[model samples]
Target chain A: MKTASPFLELEAAPARATVWFDGEPLDLPQGANLAAALLAAGVAVFRHTPASGAPRGPFCLMGACFDCLVEIDGVVRQACMLEVEDGLRVTRPHEAEDSGAPV
Target chain B: MRQCDVIVVGAGPAGMAAAATAADAGLQVALLDEQPRAGGQIYRDVDRVAALRGGILGKDYTEGRALTAAIRRDGIEHLDGAVVWAIEDGFCVSYTRAGQAAQVSAPKVILATGALERPMPLPGWTLPGVMTAGAGQILLKQSGLLARRAVLVGTGPLLYLIAAQMVRAGTPPVALVETQTRADLMRANRHLGGALRGWPYLAKGLAMLAELMRARVPRYTGATTIAIAGDGRAEAVTFRSGGKPRTVACDTVFLHHGVVPNTQAARSVGVPHRWDAAQHCFNPVVDAWGGTAVAGVFLAGDGAGIGGAKVAETAGRIAALKVAEELGRLSADERDRRAAPLNRLRSRQTAIRPFLDAAYPPFAEALAPADATLVCRCEEVTAGEIRGYAKLGCIGPNQTKAFGRAGMGPCQGRYCGLTVTALLAEATGQTPDQTGYYRIRPPLKPVTLGELAAMDDGARDAAE
Candidate 1:
């Protein structure tokens, strides 16, 4: 069943791809814009700032602002610039650091 | 490494036209874009979006289909998903594609890098659900996603365009909180003649406004002290409209003042820039043909200045003609003959700019946000800190790096450069030009150490 979301997807995708966001699996539209797909899937916060630990999401979907920075394959990249691919593991950058996890 | 006669960085209207024009003149051209498709932000995924939701974004967007199709001709190589990080001396361009670094060099380079939404730094602007109106449009264009109960804020044609688009998508914004006032329109009255010459653009704006009104989307004009209030996400927008405080509840807040040239790539290449007082941003100093002081380097489109997409396309053609002449592909006489019409069209297209700039000038508060507002999102630097730096004898953006690491973050001051300059200028009572901008360095986009090392290895292998 499609989950209730504040964001609505206007088009139906040909397929669904399961991508993990911070270890939670989300079945997003295959090959859809990653940031949009995540938002439609009810994942609002993409990362938390290292300074004040404030939540940040994609502000400029065109890749100007770095607010949408997410850790993928151990590298931080803009989620807005990426596409939703099946089995892609994405995590919020600075989450461990902000949570006082070991460096 | 790949070699071409001309290389165009960005696949937007300017870059597309440049590549297509140069290629049509028998010059080898490679067009590089950050997106996975040819359409730059203006036409982001135009081919797909137009096919799926025809006319939802309106004719202005779908019209880009012709330009996007123009690049399909022979001799034009389109490289997508390429994040150009550097334009080194000798016109060598370095970009990363699919986690691998690549190099493409050319005798001439056209930086048609396009524009970025002028940063609107209000309180709670960094909240999770607060995004630029351009972002909202991109969501609709790229993924056909629309925010539920969103409120469009700020002043500009783009804000209205997005509101109309949302209404077309059956999800009209709850309201529009506009900051432009009658005084702004009065200030813009002097440019009415020129704006009249650009009647099509004026007509489009009026039509979009009419569409919003017909949809009954309440619009609050002459709003001030606008701020987003939320716990961790945007819950509502608060502002003073017509001398009365009002709060509009919404899940999303789309903010936009206007767009300015995305000059980071051009600046990275050491091209000189000057403050555009009318547009209130720094733009590259370029000739009519888009040639800069940097030899063999040219710029076109919004990256040169904030002329819209149509102006950018004409500028691209004019620049390509000049570049072709420089490369001996066309005679000076032929280049001039070909460029004359384009130059005229570009001027006509840009006629609406002065009026638009004066009428919907960037919100005054956003130009220099409150002391507590976060100016530098990456460094989490506050506007107060920037002012403090100015007080401590900090002259320009570079010095802020040492004082508080303002422009040293991943974005490299793309978002906060103008605000920092404005803050420093206000605090020190210096002009924005005197206050100056960040010395943009490459890699322009963030690249991993592994990618850089691998790039070096790739270069060495190519040499061997």
Candidate 2:
């Protein structure tokens, strides 16, 4: 899962605190968009489609496309729309399919 | 509860300019935007990120700093991160900010909600690594991020601009898969005289193309049969170039064709709209100053039509001046005198729009995607399913949505509305105007029940 980032960490930019995703703490840049922070940390798989079970990620990061929906603090929101905050907990929202047997 | 002389719907180029102008004329203005900052998609975070990101976002984008500064200096009440859910009669706007409910009312309302990328639902577009070129730019603009290896797809100036931006950011896309045919460019040559008036835009596009060429990115033009294929994430894009099937291996596929006016807010308020035959979308019918048939309601910027940022800025100013005149803050003659230069500049700015519209139309085949291709990514409805609904006498997008639930998603039909409209038109053999758009309801974006219950009914009642 090694993805080289093209974003340069400019010295003038403010330093951000680390956030946790799936129990792993990631040191992401302060004030960067949450989606970019996750991607910068090599976590691109944001969520899976409810119907098709296909992996889906950010598209039209300006809130037009809802593909970047991720669960944060018990709610799902577009990751690109929310800014990265210190100590924020984020997790990929999963919708389980019916196994065809009665629960 | 807050009452203002005018409430501007968006804080983008149009809304910012509108608020500034009205406030300058002694009107109390309330500007609302869903984003944490002003500057709509075109200038998202321009006040902060543009200067920090340096030359990657381009000069036009950074120019939003001026608008942001002007609005702040004008002492206008700016409500950032406000999700306006409902607009009642008499211009009462119900919105939520930071999980708190608030209502703002005014006699006049200006809708500058802006434009969105035209939908292109191709096979495998729902894959993880696939996205729009505008989305890719958002990553760069908002977070300074880029894909490792991307293959840009489709056509239009935004595609080239994003490619150039990527090159500047030191991560040029692996290739460009263009759907526009050589014949299309030849067809656009007819309007070259008008297009030449805006030489700077054309020259900027050319410079971007040259940059892509210099970067040695393989550009496949006139591509037919463009498709993205992957197991779980995007692996490669297959497109036909020069009548030969070609596949480019890439991790990301960014798609774009053109933009269309976002008329949801206007359409929701029952504002009149007409289909623009050239742009192939609904244009809100407005006067010279963005005033709609609905008295107090105005439509400005790309929400009225796709005239780019400069045109949106001018349209916003004109709309504000009109508001000032209506409020008796300025005489009609004075308003017109102030607006004349902006009107002239807007005309010159938009002179080349017809040419661009004709040149980079949305992919016709995308209107009728393969039977299996997903039209509604949220609901997993396919084009074939929508066509089936159309064949069954579903005359409009709303009816199709009722039958199959294509647009009943979290996005509220932002991505699929135009595609559904076009698909229904192609299937039903009716014009897009007859096909119509989705019927947007109140609580437009999802709002919490608590936020709704907490609203001050007194404010809304007073305005009504």
Candidate 3:
């Protein structure tokens, strides 16, 4: 009826990780995506609209939706589709963040 | 353990057909079915729904009522709402009844657990109104009601049948988005020659299409729904129409890639499966008589192959013949005569399989869900996490479970296993069948710690 999850205890990945995200020193499993690692790290709200200021998060997790767009390295790509790297720099643009009080 | 002569699981078309055929042969059959009613998802219990909604039986399920009605007669013990979790040597079945651990022992076992529709992961597949094609059909068949202006996304006859039903139920879809090309449909139709003998089936399906056409349901072939643009519920779907992207405003987007056999129980028992290229899913190989590689265990219906209700009915009959022969109840000549119609049906099924398989070949390219797409929706595991688990020498789902915590949650891999398997297949270049479904075991659902401690003898308290 049930079984234990293998990834439940896994914290890190193989050594010498090289890929990078927004522009931060990220500690994540090798080959994991920015969205998944971020989700694991509790960064549920990934991006926001500039005009409406509505909160946007990774919805489909698949690249089909494009709801998880973030500034990775340099280009605006779907965070749900890309793998992770050490020392990745990930940043939320002012337009991509809700500017109201810290809710 | 309380013992019985035979225990047939899944009260659907195959199980009912199997139990009835065996009973007709004078074997005391104990039929264990998970649904509150006998009909599996195909006959999905719409007697009341049909009584309410009207005209949703759609021929295939209408034919199933006769077999279920046969269960009401004596000698066939129908245990509805009884979910069988595991089977052991001597065919000890572990299941739950009234939230209590229970078991049923039988000499011979027949697994007729049927197939389920494959939910293609798109942007909004998780949305409220977005559902599998079968789910939509169940809604209409049972309630004779539906949301207005649907966009049915899928391939094969399921979409055709369901869309036509939707029109009848008052939805009247704007257009049907088919993933198979017209050329593929032509190739699918070529097998129609061999299948021409099943004229009634052909006519019935054609009639559904006619309803859709008469209602002006524009069918766009080779289209895939890539995006669903709406808040909360589905308001519109953005799909690639014939390779060119377009958007259709429809409240409901009924989706179904195709059907895949529910294989968790089989996987748990180590039942080996072959890559059924025609079904694009893993299926256990069984002899014409329904005997699997495992002794005393027989496979039947869509669980063995993704054939329709007719094939399922015949498969059930063949299992009964084999069981009767094993019990020395069937004379050789009688058995041969009884098996004739099924053999003919198999030949016809073989003829059309190639076209159906080619047309609906599991949406391979769409397997890789975006990072946000929840692989294990219950545990919030994403496709990216699954990929991470894949690189760590985890070749199978069981091993991946150790590294990702994805499938080990409530909903028990129902929402995520297919999506994960497809992702694994894409990464490893293995077919979808090779990526095994979740392994089922006793306590098919979570139980309290006290319940485990209270367990005693596994054999039934008393035989039905």
Best-matching candidate per lDDT: 1
lDDT of 3 by residue, A9-77 (tens): 122335534433333344566655456565444353455544344445554342223445676433455
* Chain A TM-score, structure 2: 0.77
CAPRI docking class of candidate 2:
medium
RMSD of each: 2.1, 3.1, 14.7
TM-score of chain B of 2: 0.97
- DockQ of predicted model 3: 0.02
Give the alpha carbon lDDT tens digit for every residue of B1-464 in model 3: 55677889888778888899888888888899865566777776644444444454555566667887888877788887565666888788876554456677787888988876664766656553465677566544432335456788877788888777666656567778777776776767766665566666567767887888798888877776567777755678787876588888876677777887766666556677776655656677788887877888888888887887767877888898888778777898888898898788766655555656765666653556776655564456777778777776566677777887667754467556767776777777776666766676644444444444444554323432
DockQ of each: 0.83, 0.53, 0.02
Residue B291, model 3: Cα distance from true site in angstroms: 1.2
User: Best candidate per TM-score, number?
Assistant: 1
State each model's CA lDDT, in order: 0.90, 0.84, 0.66
Candidate 1 local lDDT, A1-103, one digit each (tens): 1235778888789899999888789989998889889989988889988877888888998888988989887678899899989999888985533344555
Q: Per-model TM-score of chain A alone?
A: 0.87, 0.77, 0.65
What lDDT tens digits, residue by residue, belong to model 1 across residues B188-307?
999999999999999999999999999999999999999999988889999999889999999899999999999998888889999988889998999999999999999999999988
Candidate 3 chain A lDDT trough over 10 residues, lowest sum: A1-10
Please provide, for model 2 over B95-155, each residue's C-alpha lDDT reduced to its tens digit, 9 standing for 90 to 100.
8888767888899999999998888899999887788888787777776677768899998
Q: Candidates ranked by lDDT, best first? A: 1, 2, 3
**CAPRI quality of model 1:** high
